[model samples]
Target: NAGIAATMPALDYPLAHWQLTMAVNVTAPFLIAQHTLRAMRRKQWGRIVNVASISGVRAGTGRLGYGTSKAALIALTRQFAIEAAEWGVTVNAIAPGPVDTPLIRGMHGGSTAGTYASMLPMRRYGTTAEIAHAVSFLASEQAGYITGHSLAVDGGFLASGLLVRDLFEPAASAPS
Candidate 1:
């Protein structure tokens, strides 16, 4: 998925950026759609599910460039959806939070070292299968009514900004 790279935009040598991320995140899919939709014009049906990231919805510290890129990618999804709708090619994005993937390993050494693994209500990293399930459903015939939507598969992490611990009542101690 090219993760962070896929979400950001381009700048000059002044920016010191990665083209793979920008192209995969923004341009390549658009071009693919351009070509595929051309073929699907008469056929009048297709689906484009862009794998966006949680960065698109909320920015974290020290991720300005990457986060900004994803925000742009979300906009691109909407724009493409508008253009492709008449052709029956519904364009949408899936913004996943911290899923357990090798990309995180590359960025943060190990899964334990990654951000918010223990903090999550699930107390574990999201599995690839979980994300794949969402994508599979998105690709199915049942998801025809859905488009221009950015679904979050982040294990309910984003729903609550603050974590509230459940406290237990003190058990009675025998007289010592």
Candidate 2:
């Protein structure tokens, strides 16, 4: 569970940023799994919970690199789950929405938080503890049957369709 919110328009996006995002968000997890799976396979029981983001499940402004990497991370989780299931290992992801973290505060503008709160069904950001609870559940023995799943810890962000009244407005429109 690693990531970098590299926000940039498609045209202005840099290859370096893309590579770095992939390296941290995707490749790092892949490598960690590669190194650890063998041991878990030997034990016939293990849990691997990855940290994904709502950005992966739903597109957003200036999230080209971040979103793409997270999407890849989700796919990678599925692939690993399929192979590791027989070994009693679970590979899952936790896609958190806007959580109250330093990283998020740094990424979001002054009004961005208020706008997101308005859009979310819960009308608030999630806490790190909430996300941790989800991860803990997936890692526990009770969740042995669950694998290859990207659980949304979002505050109904993924389930949302329309929240704003002015659908015609560009700001209220869906992300391009």
Q: How far is candidate 2 from the true structure (C-alpha RMSD, Å)?
A: 3.9
Candidate 2 per-residue C-alpha lDDT over 50-123 given as tens digits, one digit per residue, 9 for 90 to 100: 99887788877677888889999999999999999999999999998889998878766687778767888999
Residue range 86-114, candidate 1, lDDT tens digits? 88777788888777778866654543443
Q: What is the C-alpha local distance difference test score of each model?
A: 0.68, 0.86
Candidate closest to the true structure, highest lDDT:
2
Q: Every model's Cα RMSD, please?
A: 8.1, 3.9
Where model 1 places Cα greater than 4 Å from the true spot, the runs are 4-14, 18-20, 110-115, 162-176
Prediction 2 TM-score vs. true: 0.91
